[model samples]
Target: MTAPRSAAPERSVVDRTLSILGAFDKDNRTLTLSDISRRSGLPVATVHRIVNKLHGWGALERCADGGYSIGLRLWETAVLAPRSSALAAAAQPHLVALHGQTSLATTLAIRDGGESICLSFVSNDADAVACYGGPGRRLPLHATAVGLVLLAHAGDLVQKEVCSGPLRPYTRHTITSGTLLKRCLAKVGREGHAVVHGALSEGRGGFAVPVRDGRGVVVAAVGVVGAVDVIRPARLAPQVRAVADAVSRCLRADRPRVAEVGA
Candidate 1:
């Protein structure tokens, strides 16, 4: 009998390229060529060719220490993503106003799969800001106020998948049980907001309200993070809701014009 052929490569060029990009994260911001190869599970030679192309195209930057990091060009391209850009633009003024009013670290985030991706963050306290993470950072759906709000409003499949267990615990207070998470999400849905204390970080709390679109679909979340004592759910919930409502209105107003153009 003829020799059986080896299995074909499972990933396409696009998949490999995206994998290389995805290899960089908050903890692994800068990586050597070998590091990329290992993280992406591609051969060093393959990584070398793709990394060179990506570097030349400004998607990746070569460092002085012979490491690679995501380039500003990638950020420029990413910010232009319609959902994030439009949401940021409409919510920027409101985010600023909220920060000015409360002097707390505020954030806007949207759900991507089971995680929440921060679109905008405003704060003066570096430590406070770091607790919530900067823009583009992925946060757990069950561990953050904005994340809980988003998860509560997400589709049933998405909610079920996230609550299926293996939920990461950022702190002792972080909800890790599937049954408990479902209960929490149900409460968030009924309340229309989420207030989490020391869930993602000890000694800190988060408050978030859902942002709806024209059809009243929850599309995003906005919230603030501060010391546990400073985050009074009763006091901050209404303020956060007001900002969310304003952003929803702005999104609703813009959607009609886009529809007209598409029409």
Candidate 2:
């Protein structure tokens, strides 16, 4: 684990604020003060003080059940994040184009620690169970194509961090061993894209390609999950690359891009 760095000055306040936000994750989107203390490793007293401040600032909201969750104000502010709103807006037309042509499930994701966070999803077929992932959902970086592509492009430190298990598996096909996962990421780096078979969900296949800025930094990953047999690179590659190209053009033209997931 990365040694928890000592929070610096007002950054501590920032960190505390983030801790409060971080308290609400995939499994626990609403948490009580005790839950926050346990999850954040903060003292209950510390959580009390910070939660008071966050609630006052409208960054968090208290539920009728006496739990806390991310506030409307936070959601509104996050909409301003380029990857969430701007990039997503630009990519929507392209995604719609792909969705019409493929009649499959398409997703856009960005790197978050050792995971890929879904920013947007467009699907032509709702029957597929994997199409159920909502925006803001997080999945392990080593398990999905977007995660692998993003991890392939990330720094070595990030690579090592992801490679280190405690790697969680969602299915039998998940790459759990560090050595094998390392090899898989290396292949993704060399290949420039990745195809993951049932790593995130069964009966689904995910393929991803990186969307880069003009300077060549990967801004996001364009991906799709579809019926396991239909996710062939030959079929999906062009659309993924095409959407990525469009997003890149927007970034170069400085128009805007949505939900550009960062490492």
lDDT of each: 0.88, 0.80
**Which ten contiguous residues of candidate 1 have the minimum total lDDT?**
254-263
Candidate no. 2 TM-score: 0.79
Estimate TM-scores for all models: 0.92, 0.79
Model 1: per-residue lDDT, tens digit, 1-263? 99987799578999999999989998899999999999999999999999999999999999999999999899999887777888989998999999999989999998888888898999999897666778888888899999999889888888898899699888899999999999999999898889999999999988999888887778889999989899998889778889999998999888832211101
Score residue 217 of candidate 1 by CA lDDT.
77
Cα lDDT of model 2 by residue, 1-263, tens digit? 88887676444777877877888875688899999999888889989999999898888999999999888998888888776675677677887788788887777777777777787888756554344465787777887788889888887888888788878887899888999989998898888899988887788888899988767788788888776798899878888899999977887788554333344
Please give the lDDT score at residue 181 for candidate 1. 96
For candidate 1, what is the TM-score? 0.92
Question: Per-residue error at 28 for model 1, in Å?
Answer: 2.0
The prediction achieving the highest TM-score against the true structure is: 1
Poorly placed runs, candidate 1 (over 4 Å): 1-4, 7-10, 256-263
What lDDT, from 0 to 1, does candidate 1 have?
Answer: 0.88
Clash pairs, model 2 backbone:
83-258, 83-259, 83-260, 84-259, 86-257, 86-258, 87-257, 87-258, 88-258
